[model samples]
Target: MLDQKLFRHPETLSALSDSLARRGFALEVNRISALENHRAELQSKTEQLQAKRNETSQQIGIIKAQGGDIQPLLDEVAGLGDALKIDQAQLHDVQEQLQAIYLSIPNVLDDSVPDGDSEDDNVESHRWGELRHFEFTPKAHPDLDKIGLDFESAAKISGARFAVLKGGLARLHRAIAQFMLDVQTQYHGYTEVYVPYLVSGEAMRGTGQLPKFEADLFKIEGKVAGDQDFYLIPTSEVPVTNLARDSIFDEQDLPQKYVAQTPCFRSEAGSHGRDVRGLIRQHQFEKVELIQFTKPEDSFDALESMREHAEAILQKLKLPYRVVTLCSGDIGFSASKTYDLEVWLPGQGQYREISSVSNTLDFQARRMKARYKNKQTGKTAFIHTLNGSGLAVGRTLVAIIENYQEADGSITVPEALRPYMNGMERIQL
Candidate 1:
């Protein structure tokens, strides 16, 4: 949330409008300005009416004390009360309208973010390792249906865009998550957390996933009657970040780092016929999420460190990948800037995104009221928030399957994962 003054302050609104324009977001400058004007008028009217009502009541008391007729004064007070109610209600409506506009506006882009309109326009920061060369035609993860990657059973149970991993495949999936959690917590300086899979609507809004991306989420109604319920978490970032919501920490607690593994559920509402065949896009997937709360001055550095934490996972597993800086237009709603790590997939003959690390700056912090008191200034300010996929577990598994597949239809376990696999060297049907 922006400071409300941005909509009305003469010196700030123009600069804010231009910044939003650069990001391809249109700001209703005129409408917001008009609404703010009306709000001011209505609020002034309300205050005046309230004062008149109080003054009339005081006059009535004086008339009664003098043993004089008080009916006329009583009547004036009644009229004042009615007028005050109307003015107050109008003021309330105008305030709500202004708030709605504020919430819908996207964050202003950072000056360093490149101007572009889509993923194709994103700038490549760098690439790591070489794309694997295959001896035979590589099979996509879905085509290697044996060893427990079964779509048929998954479809029968839950319809399309779903899969069921069994036996060795299921074990491998679990291992990927465990390995990621270890890398994030033990090596990356993140505290491990177990967050609720379901969270309140406010939690979703705080993370910039609601009132705009609600269709992309799965909302669960209360099991009983007439109950307003919770939303299934689309990412652990929602719940974990909300931990700092409405909270103020000491400056010493400046950087709070957290990691969690959770089953994310998404409706994938607007995506139709895209990545429709495999785990590339799914209704349900597992992810190891990393979140950080840092001082405003340190946020950009924190974003770089967080991205490296994600890249370390792919590097350790020997996966080929590239990093791209998301253009202003392609960045997520809450993020001021973002870096996406796309892992090379031999089976697909392309690089697919495995993680996105973003620095939301103070955008999300303002929304959730997450703050820290600065000891030197004796003032409180919003803490900057950052989040990333320490790596999407399912996609990492897909990369491993295709990159390490043997001509004999067996899958070689990445050495880093061998211990988690109980020293099992490979999986074969």
Candidate 2:
């Protein structure tokens, strides 16, 4: 949610709308303006009526004490009370309308974000590692031999966009997640956390996922009566970042870092024909997520550091990848700025996104009421929040299969993951 103060001034609100326009979001400025005006009028009327009622009541008491007729004064007071109630209700309704508009507005793009319409316009930051050249034709993960990557069984059990891995392929997927968790926690100084895969709608709203991206989510009804419905988490970002919801941290706690490993569920709505062949696009996938809460002044720097943290995992695994700064139109709703890490896939003959690190600034903090108290000023202010995928486990597994394939159809394990695989160097049929 945007700061209410921004909407209080027409110039600021217009500026915000213009900023969001760069992201292709059409903010209804005129509607908000009208609502604000009506809210102000109703509030003023309600206050005036209350004041008049109080005065009339005092007059009635005085007249009755002097033994004069006070019925007229009593009647005026009753009318004022009814009018005040009506005005108060009107005021409440307008305020709710304004809040709904604010909740739907996305974060303003950072100045550093490039202006572009889509992913094609995103600027590449840098490239890491070297893309391997294969002597034979590279096979996509689905075409790789043995190791049991089954989509047929998964489709039978749970329709399309789901997969079942067996033997070495399954272990490789687990190893990738464990390796990412260890790297983020041990090397990146992030505290390891286990978060819920199902969260409340409020928690989703707190993270800027509800109201806007609801169609892309999976909602589950509660089995017991009176229990609130829960939504399956699209990412660990929801529960991990919501840890700071309605919290006030001391100045010394300016930066809080946490990493979580969880299975993410997404409806993949509107993505009917893209990446439907393999693990590239799945209804359910595992990801190691990194989250940080920091003072406003330190968030951009934290964003860069977080991006490096994610890049380090690919570097350790020696996977060829590149980083790109997401353009305004390509960024997420809650993020002010974002960097995506795309790993090379020999099978696809191109780089695909494996991780995305974002600096949401105070966009999510304002929604969650997550704040920090300043030691010097003794005042609380919204905290900046950031989240990123350290790496997508399924995608990493895909990269390993495609990048490490041998002429004999066996897969060589990346050295970093060899220990996790019990010193096994090659996986063959």
Candidate 3:
């Protein structure tokens, strides 16, 4: 959202000079430059009381058209309409506190990122294939705890990080979310939506997931006692990037593209004990996201073509991935450049992040105003949003069950998901 006139301008500290240490973001851009100098001094005292109430409405229409005494110009136009209604209600409370601090600041990085603060300063950038060396000493997806992979019956029906999948591993986790929604909708053209896993806290503050990742999400409510309910999305990039929330497209729809698969939920609340085993970190999973809406000069080339459509589903399931690029504190909240991808697990030898690709340029389309139009100067701007993870369908089913496992343990069904598993190759019982 970052545009309260670029919080104290100077191009918002040179556009957050590459995510000022990733996502700490210059202490919230120095607290939105002190609320943009109190909304530019109450917008110059409300434009000097609307130019002294339009010159006191032309001196009360020339003092009642010069008829005898017009009560001394109506007592100076009733004291300039009570001081122009207190400088227009203090310039509408300093432009609603400078739109609650620049629509909740974010986005502004991309200077070849790579700084540092968290995620071990995240900056791997490349490395693809070469881990599977398990000569009979591998087994780690909770050691497939009894064939159907129950996970203590999903922690006794929904307790710790839930997971249930029965039979052929719930058809291999629903064929890895229908093979990542048919490869992100027929080979990366994206558009296959379904949305709404419950949203609206202004669509999770238009994608930055509200006032600081709301402790990694999961909310829901029937509203009341203290209001502000609704939540439970955590991804589908919060309802496919709020489907252009406030709307205004048409620069030939610049570059809409979308894709869903849904069920995300999260609330991993500070990741308590981190990756507490199996399906690594989860509070409900299933993904396939990949939103977009380009046009800030095509958002860093649509984040390198959505990170090559999540590395073309790990190069058509031959797996072995790597792509990284997220430094500047492991970029994310309304990213201004990111990459991720990761994959190549092989019993967790390393590389994980199953897809990311970002570029949130217009910072969530100026907080969901989501505009477009500028076809060679037609005007209407704000449109850079993006979202990714064209994978994450349960971490690509835990990176295809630890990279096509198989020490006679059976798993191999990858040739682009064996035609969505109907003609599956392996996953033996």
Candidate 4:
């Protein structure tokens, strides 16, 4: 959401052009220039017409006051009014066209971001702990036989991409969410929040979810219990990050930390074939989201701290994981830079992302108009926004099931969660 005026300015445009080009987004400079030219022309014509109409109206008033035939002045004023109307219409058209271009223009990526197209191109920053070498062949998660958990039954009850965890399994899932929330709020300096599961289109747009990824949301059909076009939230981050929308904050309160556990829902329309068997991907899952609002200078520090906060959960649980920096194209629409914490999943025989931490800079804050005032300059500026999954609750469960599995088919509950699980050390079925 860089200013359109800056894109038009020669010096600013050159720096922006170089930054975007390095990040692999060939800025549509020509199209933007054409739209800007049309807007400039239309605005000039509108201003001139408005000035002429005002002067002619004053002349008509004077003629009528003088008791003279006002037809000639009236006719001239009427022609000016018509021209003004035409100018107004053209102004409206050109403004709309310019706005369309502005809205579509993406934020320039950070130079630190690696140039790549997909998840595979992301850089592996660092990894912790070693994978346990099992003497027996590891079984896939769907083949888990000891636990009463059944994905097939879940599918039968609620179609594909659903999961059913009854008895101890349900308790364990809840325990994981509580554990993540506790660590984030109590240890990591995040204020806990409980947000609405449903949100408006504006909230989604503020987070860069609409227009491009409408297929991934569960939009409520028709009118709900109340009159509103609400979408089931895909993440708690949507509401939490939007807390500062259209508001200004004090500089002292610059970095705001928020943590929330909510049930997230996603249609995930495009991921039709992948992870079809278990909790690796699901329609509804619980998550503890971490969101931060900070000054531009403090954003990168916030990013690393958020990543470590996510890693702390796994480390406490004794789950092996690695941190990775997401490449340019693989990063989300609003993220200038991102880090993903991928926990080791023995069942999948590879690392899978359990949390994604991103420093969005001012991209989302600008879109949401969230800002803070500099006391010295008396100027309000967009705050940098960052959000990360402390851990995706359902995927954490999957990782635990896979990574902490025993050769005998029973699952060992991670030590950190044992206290939450009533001192239980294993799930023996």
Candidate 5:
């Protein structure tokens, strides 16, 4: 949510309008201005009526003390009360209208974000490791041999965009998640967290997933009467970042880092035919998520560090990958800037996104009312929120399977995961 103060300054509002335009959002400047003006008028009227009512009540008290007739004063106060109610109602309605518009607005793009219309326009930052040259034609994860990547059974139970891994393959998936959690918690200085997979609508909204992207969520209606709907988390980011919602931290607690592994559920409403074959896109997927809340000025730097933390997992696994700076139009709704880590997949013979690190720059914090007190100024202000996929467990499994497949179809487990896999170096049928 943008600061309401931004609307008060014509220059800042215009600049914000321009920035939103670059993200392909058309700000209704005229409508916003009109609504704001009407809100101001109504609020002023409400305040004046309130003040007048107080003054009239005082006058009535004085008149009674003097033994004078108070009926006329009583009548005048009743009329004033009626008028005040009307103005107050109008003010409330206008404020709600303004809030809806504000909630719908995307965050302003960072100055450094490049202008572009699509992912094709995103700029590559750098690459790591070398793409492997296959002795034979590399096969996609779904087509690879016997190490259990079951889809038929999953379909019988749960329909499309779902899979069930068994045997060594399932263990490998668990191993990958464990390795990521250990790396994020032990080396990267992030506190490990266990978050509920189901969260409230407000929690979803706090992380910028509700109202606009509600279509992409799995909403569970309460079984009992009058129960609020619960949504299966789209990412651990939703619940983990929301830990700071409606909270105020002291300056020494300026940065809070948390990591969690969760099974994310998404409706995938807009993606109909894309990546329908494998785990690349799933209705349910496991992800290791990283979240941070930081002082506003330090968020961008924290974003870079978070990106590096994600990259460390790929490097340790010896996976080839590249980082790309997302263009304005390609960025997420709540992110001021984003960097995507695209890991090399031999099966697809191309790079595919495995993680995205973003700095929301108080975008989520404003919605969540997450703030910190400034020690020097002794004032409270919204903190900056950042989230990233330390790595998607399923995608990393896909990468390892394709990249480590032997000529005979056995997979040589990445050394980094060997400890978690109980020193079992290879997974074979």
Candidate 6:
């Protein structure tokens, strides 16, 4: 939600709308202003009615003390009650309208975000490693599917966009997640956390996932009485970041880094026809999530650091990848700025997104009321929140399968993952 003060000032609201236009988003400036104006008028009228009623009640008390007729004063006070009720109801309606408008507004892009309208306009910041040259023709994951990668069985059990791995491939997928969790927690100084797979609607709203984008989520009905709406988490980012909701932390807790590995569930509603045949898109997938809470002044620098942390996973796997700065229009709903790490996939003959690192500044914190007290200023302020996929374990597995595929149809285990595989050198049919 945007700062309410922006709606009160037409000039500020106009400037904000213009800024959003650069990102190819529109803000209902006039409608929001009208609601705010109506709310102010209703509030003023309600206060005036209360003041008049209070004055009339005092006159009635004076007449009663003098043993004089006080019915006129009493009736006058009673007459204001109906009018006050009407004003109060109108005020409530106006307030609700303003709140709805606020909730619908997306976060404003930071000035640093490039002016663009789509992913094609995104700018590549850097590249890591070189794309491996293949002597023999490479096969896509679906074509190479066999004993280990089985989509046929997954479809029978669940539906499309699901996969079942057996033996070496399943083990390899688990190893990828373990390795990522280890690297992020042990080397990158992030604390490992285990979060709930199902969260409340409040948690979803706190993280800016509800009120919009609900169709992309897998929602679960609460079975018990008095239970609120529950939804399976699309990413561990939701559960981990919501830990700071309604919290007031000490300045020393300004930089809290957390990591978690979880099976993310998404509906893939908007991407129906895309990646329909491969493991590229799935209803359920695994990811190592990274989240951070930092002081406002240090967040941008933290964004760069977090991006590097995600990049480290690709580099360690010896997989070639590139980092791109997401243009304003392509950035996530809550992120003010974002960088996506796209890894080379020989099977696809292109780079595909493997991770996305984002710094939401205070946008998410404001929504969650997650804040910290500054010792220097002795004032409280919203904390900056950030989250990223240290690496999507499924995509990493796909990259290793394609990039490490041999002409003989066997897949060579990357040296780094060999230890996790118990020194297994390769997987052969």
Clashes of each: 0, 0, 3, 0, 0, 0
Q: Please report, in order, the local distance difference test score of every candidate based on alpha carbons.
A: 0.91, 0.91, 0.75, 0.85, 0.93, 0.89
User: Which of the numbered candidates is closest to the native, going by highest TM-score?
Assistant: 5
How well is each residue in 229-311 modelled by candidate 1, as lDDT tens digits?
78999999999999999999999997999999999999999899799987899999999999999999999999999999999
**Model 4 weakest 10-residue run by lDDT:** 98-107
- True-vs-predicted CA distance for residue 265, candidate 2, Å: 0.5
Better of 1 and 3 by lDDT: 1
Kindly list the per-residue Cα lDDT of model 5 for residues 1-429, writing each as its tens digit. Answer: 888888866787798888789999998888888998899889888899999999999999999999999999999999999999999888999999999999999888889999999999999999999899888999999997587888999999999999999888899999999999999988989999999998998998898997999999999998433798899999999999999999999989878999999999999999999999989999999999999999999999999999999999999999999999999889999999999999999888899999999999988999999999999999999999999999999999999999999888889999999898899988887
Give the Å shift of residue 190 in candidate 5: 0.7
Q: Pick the candidate with the highest lDDT.
A: 5
Please list all clashing residue pairs in model 4, or write none if there are none: none
Give each model a TM-score. Answer: 0.95, 0.96, 0.36, 0.92, 0.98, 0.95
RMSD of each: 1.8, 1.8, 18.0, 2.3, 1.0, 1.8
Candidate 6 per-residue lDDT over residues 32-132, each given as its tens digit: 88888888899999999999999888888888999999988877777899899999999998898887777777788888889888999899999999888
Instruction: Please list all clashing residue pairs in model 2, or write none if there are none.
Output: none
Instruction: Give me the runs in candidate 3 sitting further than 4 Å from their true place.
Output: 1-42, 46-81, 93-106, 113-124, 128-164, 167-203, 210-227, 233-263, 266-321, 326-333, 336-341, 345-393, 400-404, 407-429
- lDDT by residue for model 4 over 391-429, one digit each (tens)? 999888888888887899878888888889999888867
Model 1: number of clashes? 0
Shift in Å, residue 143, candidate 4: 1.3
Question: Between the candidate structures 3 and 4, which one is better when assessed by TM-score?
Answer: 4
Local lDDT at 385 for model 5: 94
Better of 2 and 4 by TM-score: 2
